[model samples]
Target: MKLKELEQLKNEGVDHISSIERRRFLKLGFLVTGVYLGGKALSLAPLTEAQAAEVVPPKGKYSYSPHYSMVIRERLCINCELCVEACNGTNDVPSYGYRTDILERRRAIVDDKYETIFMPVLCNHCNRPPCVRVCPTTATWKDETTGIVKMNPGRCIGCKTCMTACPYNARYFKEEGRFVDKCNFCYDTLLSKGAKETACVTACPADVRVFGDLADTNSRVYELLHTPETLVWVLRPKTGALPNVYYTNA
Candidate 1:
């Protein structure tokens, strides 16, 4: 069967499963297992050299100048939610909305003992952002200087196309402001004000979040990316966004 067929079957299975079973299955890490099985099903068809080469980027195809990126140290997140508070205060975010948030995943570590992983999520600031592509008024765009995905509230038409386009559920409608809102890595509020880092990064006591320029080789983000034997990944890689935000245990 094709990968799409497998995905259809997965969705069908999800629909048939009871809520409690689904929740229990997810807690036991069955979601990853199902995805792995789907990938294995797809591996039956091997790609040719030309087909594989199409996925590679050409030389000197850099998207942004500074290439601002963030690294999430997943193991360090303590779920204190200090970063969320800092973001709310720094950006004047309302109580009903959020620019960033944490999610919890449980995995069985021992007999009846489950360990929790706190995942912090935000706007990925993709190189080929779907949100930017779907914006009808060109209100949301990826910044050329810093590569951060930005929103122009004045230009927004309240269409919410960008909100639907985001796979990570990053964008939210700010009803009072009458526009879509999202995380821009604090470029306008902090970086433009001569701050070295974002409010969330500064507030993270566990040092879970690292924001820096990816284009600079001397930067800590560069060093982290170059580190050997480390697993670096992004959320929703299948979406083909090429996100700047990376997650790793190291």
Candidate 2:
């Protein structure tokens, strides 16, 4: 139904609603759950177990020719914050904001022993970027050639719509420029200058962050993701953003 027509419909009191109408509403609820909850919550998948490959794009099937991507080695992160410093310095990020940050988690290993895991996170540069979709002024968009979610600072009116749409919480409003800013994978700083790796990747002493073109099979990022027996995953996969950034301990 057209939005205007639906809006014009008289509100049927809940007590007077028909059974078929209730059923339709319930069906839609289930469909939404199945999509955002990966079908497991409602047991929508019955034939076979879901595979890791479901989240990953097929090999050699990258949408962009360069297909810029990153693979975070979860176990190698040490919380040194060098990567964070490099990113802020390279991108000219404000003191109150961060383009990337490290998250800490403690998990039991064996015999009452717990290990601290430091997780470094940044913008995923998703294939279906919600940020681009919600921007009212065409301030942000996903670059077609590099798959980088770029922002036109001058065009941003500080609406923060893209910030709300980002599932990873990657965007922040920049007070200096009076615009929203997020990670662009050092595109303007390094990639545009013929550099292969981002500032964060180069500054990481632990070698935790691997950045490269995923379209190249021989690239480190591709091997880390496609290697046998390695568990590759993304943050907030239920958002269906199809993020380019992957995580693994391989």
Candidate 3:
């Protein structure tokens, strides 16, 4: 359905799916699971003579976190800030306290070698998240499937426990509001479970951010984790949250 049609249906209260709907979907899990994976592999596989095809390999990436966090691909990044802009437009995140911010740092290597590097910083959506522990109220929780940490503004007491707990400085408190918020990695966008990628990923000019699963051994994110060049660095490791964000070393 088109966006307008979907919104109209929602207004008409057609959004609710009852137990029968849920159970019916559950019953087809095995069959649906195979079809989905098989179809994807087929799409990615080389075309046969009988196959009608034109486009080369479909462009984009996937995540497999079991609720895994979003992956950022640094090499593909040109620091365009489309992710930041998309984020601001999507969540209305404050102008200064960005849910995603670009950070630039200069490092001097041995002797005189020096270079300036820029990286986009945001919530790492960690496992063993310290923000969860420091919360005065249980407002932040990690999703099981995507590993994206989310906020419950209604539950937050605005104590700022989470803000202090993050090592990457990914947490932020709104200036006009007394609530904590961070990236949920576009959960609403990924529901279709198809070639459709996240807004930030799609908006990316350099296509640097790769969103997918961290747990599945065969997933791109998973393979990235094992790559010899991959580097997961905390802005300050001493702070807390064992972040899921990583940078590939060239």
Candidate 4:
């Protein structure tokens, strides 16, 4: 049912609670089945040749967990397309929006210099995931031990409230589908066997990303995430999603 039509029904004094609920479902359904359905197709490709490589992060407490703990290595990423191909290939994204998302901010340089730096964006796998809080159905979840946010398409009522609830804009819906989707730290590829890293971290030509645990001080991911020398940022902190994704100079 259309939003306008729903409103019309409400205006007509139709006290149908089911209609209101159905309207809510349709709002989210459009995002999955309508707008971004082609994202996976845009990302269709083969995994990187170095898909099996492992990262040796600096020593820290969380080193033992070996989850794909997302870290934006500010210095190493040159905005190259290698990781893009790597992610699409690994996931068969089936749409242009595969696993990788590039972030660009316009900046003006001195003496009329102007340029923009491209940074890849994806799910940060926050400790306190807002996406989990807003789902009408219990579709999105965060693992306590791994610190990775996960999705269940089976439980998703095609409601995308999680998308708007997220400040990082990490949650994405597919075109002509009926479910919301986003990066789950590549749990399917890198962590399925309980491995220690992700394809994106392994395939990065410049080694800009890091993976590990957030709680263990012994883990490399945790140390890098906390160190002052290395920059770590959550996208749109003002929005208060408390995103776990961290970025250096970017």
Q: Worst 10-residue stretch by lDDT in candidate 3?
A: 50-59
True-structure lDDT of candidate 4: 0.66
Report the lDDT of model 3 for residue 44.
Answer: 37
Tell me each candidate's TM-score: 0.76, 0.78, 0.63, 0.67
TM-score of model 1 (CA atoms): 0.76
Candidate with best lDDT = 2
- lDDT tens digits by residue: candidate 1, 1-250: 7645554553544487755666687767877887889897674333121111212223234356677889999999999999999999999899999999999999999789999999999988887788987887889987768888899999999988898999999999999889999999998899999998999999999999999977777888777766888888888777777788889999
For model 2, the superposed segments whose C-alpha errors exceed 4 Å read: 1-53
| Model 2 Cα lDDT, one tens digit per residue, 115-234 | 999989999998878898789888998898999999999999998989999999999999999999999999999999999999999999999999999999999888888899989999
RMSD of each: 16.0, 9.8, 19.9, 14.2
Number of clashing residue pairs in every model? Answer: 0, 0, 13, 32
Give the Å error, residue 218, model 1: 0.8
lDDT of 4 by residue, 209-237 (tens): 87766656777767776677654566666
Judged by whole-model lDDT over C-alpha atoms, candidate 2 comes out at 0.88
For model 4 the local lDDT of residue 36 reads: 71
TM-score of 2: 0.78
